[model samples]
Structure formats: structure tokens, C-alpha cells
Target: MCQDVIFHEIYSAGLLGEISLGLKRDTVEGLLGEPQDISVSSTPYILNYGSLQLSFSSNDPHATLQSIHLYFDEIVEFPHGLQLEGWLPNKSVSAEEFLIHAEHFNVVLEEDEQHTFKNPQIGFKSKADVIVVFTIEEESVKLYSIHLGKRPR
Candidate 1:
């Protein structure tokens, strides 16, 4: 299948994950297995990745990814296509930077106690449904998380 490029920012500043945008549909499929689903409008196409939703404009390049929203995961934006080629000392800029570039709306990062990058037991009903439970060591910020239902509601 053919698709506009998509990106995701599910990792923290210190973690490792590659979520690029404006990727060719086949390229994205190659990187992310395949979109959980797909939708289309007159001038835009949507591809649903694991927890990432991408929107592309027909006015943009063939693989021009417009934006990405990782709904529940803390990080949910991307850097402009130019900055990556510079010396940023980052895997893909910082979470703070991605937010500004994404023009984030009324989203909030709960607490280190609310989300984690390690062994997070996430489940899905479709692709958007997520249940996250995490904890932070009061002084150190060591994080732990489990599936929402593994314990209870």
C-alpha cells in the first residue's frame, strides 16, 4: 500500500525509539509493521500506527507527514524536517522541542508516577484505547508501570 509519511514521539529524552513523519506509506509500514487502520478524506489521509495517529495533506509532498498525536503517551509531536540534520545532541530533539513544533493543545503530562517507558503493559481495544499505570520513586524518579487491568479499574 502507499501512504504519506508518519511520525511518532513515544520516547523520553533519555530513551530510544524512532518515529519519523512524512515517510512513504510503505516505508512507514516497513518500520512500524503496519498501521492498525486507515482512513481518507478529499485532501488528507490518515494512518493509524500502534498508538500514533498521523494526518497528511495532499498539498504536501507525497511522503510529507503533517503531524502525529500519541494521544496518551507524554511525547506527541515532531521537529521540523531541517533540525534533525544539525548537531542537537539528541536522538530527535527534546520532548519540549517537539511540543512547540507540534503546536500542542491542552495536553498535560501527569507525573513521572503516571507513565513509564519500561515494560509498560499496554493493551488496546482498537488502536486508540490505552490504559497506563506507573509509579515514581519520590526522590529518585525511578519509574514502574503495569497494565491498567492487570490489577484493577
Candidate 2:
């Protein structure tokens, strides 16, 4: 149970609230408040804000926010433009179907070797901080557990 949990809408350019790649760690911490858990014993710091997990790169002195993972079961919303092909949480859809619809948005979700599909263009690809990831099981994708990340340059 997280106190002061807020529903930050995901924006079309792969932004979750004020969070994005290259954002300083403190800025993210300020926006989300104290994380329920912080794994600081690793190179890339991991902060858990309830069901939403954020990973930060340690290469920078400030530990910039690198990626964000949100659970479908978690209570969060996306702006109309950022919604994943209009697929909402708890909505059942097949992987193939999702891939087809994503194409219309210029987002191509290709299955990776890890049995997941990812679209690099989900965010501002030019900045390399935006990507959309999905996990599939039994041909159906879980609405929760979707990941969005920006690579640390």
C-alpha cells in the first residue's frame, strides 16, 4: 500500500507524468514521493513505487531515470494519445491482434527473443528514451506488466 499514490497519465511521447529518460533521480523521487522500496545495492538503482518500478542508470552522478515498468493491475491511466492502441487494462487481446493495431499508430511491436514484443517508437525515438514493451502468455498478452523505457546514453 503506497501513500499518496498518484495516477500519472502516460503521454503519447512515452512520458509517465513528469518522468522520462535522462531525468535526474531526485526529480523522479520528488514527483512520486518516497518509493516503497529502493534497491540501492546495485549499479542501476531500482525504485519501486507500489506496482510501478523505475530503474535508473548509475553512470551519472545523479542517477538519471532510465526506464519505467507499470503493472496492468496497477491503477494508472494514459492520455488519449498515449494509450496503447486504445487497449486498456483488463482488456483481453491477442498478441497478433495487438501487433496489427499498433501498426496503425506507426508503432511496430516485434516479438523479441524473450517472448516479449517491443516498439522503440513508443516514445520520442530520436532521444532514445521511449519504448513500449509487452509480455505474452498463451498467445494472449497481459494488460498489466507493460514496460516503457528510455535507454541511457
Candidate 3:
């Protein structure tokens, strides 16, 4: 089955997408249909929607959703194709522009040694969980592949 894309929207208030935090597995299925595969090993349960992946916490007895990661040429939005305070993803420019946009929204980001930028506060449903990462290259940033989830304890 052809699955519709889950646009990752960075809003001034929070994130909006096909798969986000605090959703039940069934709700996710209702949103994106049955996933191509599911992983429930020793690690957190994962629902793979092609390139996009939704990771749920093991502690969730009801299987509440915890995180969302998008890669493999996924599209992002600020929820329903709206811009976040006039900030939107621009594919025409370099990745630096993306960083600038994030800064414009006053998003607090922490850059790792590998040059990856993460704003844990941006895309999580649980207040205690945060782990969204943006991959930046030498000349541009790859918005197609982003990570949204809780930090592992």
C-alpha cells in the first residue's frame, strides 16, 4: 500500500506530524495505516513507516508513543503545511538557512561533536522525554532525515 508522507512541522508551540509522542500504536496505525514492519526485541518497540520510524517507550504499558524519526526523503511541515512563525523549510538554500530558521524560532539547540544539532524540547509529547536531532553537512543540512524522541536513560 502507498503510504502518505508524514510532514514534520516545527511550530512555535510544539510539533505536529503523522506520528508524534503520546499516541497509541493503534492510533498511529489509524493515522498512517499498518506499518511495513514492527520491531519488539529487547529494545524499545519500533514501528517502521518506510524511512520514517516511530519509537515507543518500553515502560508504556498501554504502548503510548514516545518518539518519531524521519529520514529517507521525508517531508516536514509546521503542522498541515503551515509555517512556524513565518519560518519554513527551504530546500533552495543551504543547510545553514535551516539552522538560521531554527534560531529564528528561538529553539535551544545543542550541537554534538559530530556536528548534529538537537532540540529536545521541540518534538516530544512527554515532558520528561526529548531527543530530536538534525543532521548537518559541510555545506547544507539534511532536513529529510531528522530524529524526534526521548533521550535514553
Provide the TM-score for each candidate, comma-separated.
Answer: 0.34, 0.57, 0.54
| Better candidate by TM-score, 1 or 3 | 3
> How far out, in Å, is residue 1 in model 2?
36
Tens-digit per-residue lDDT, 1-153, candidate 3? 322122224323225444457778677666676677788563588877656577776534468777766553434322222122433343343445555654554454444434333532112221322233344445444444455554456
Candidate 1 lDDT tens digits, 66-139: 55444433433332221222111122333344334323422233324234444432121111122223323232
Q: What is the TM-score of candidate 3?
A: 0.54
TM-score rank order: 2, 3, 1
TM-score of 1: 0.34
Candidate 3, position 63, lDDT: 82
How well does candidate 1 match the true structure, expressed as C-alpha RMSD?
14.1
Candidate 3 regions with alpha-carbon error over 4 angstroms: 1-12, 40-42, 58-61, 72-93, 104-144, 151-153
Candidate 2 regions exceeding 4 Å error are 1-12, 59-61, 74-106, 113-139
Q: If the candidates were sorted by their lDDT against the true structure, best first, what order would they fall in? A: 2, 3, 1
Provide the lowest-lDDT 10-residue window in model 2: 120-129
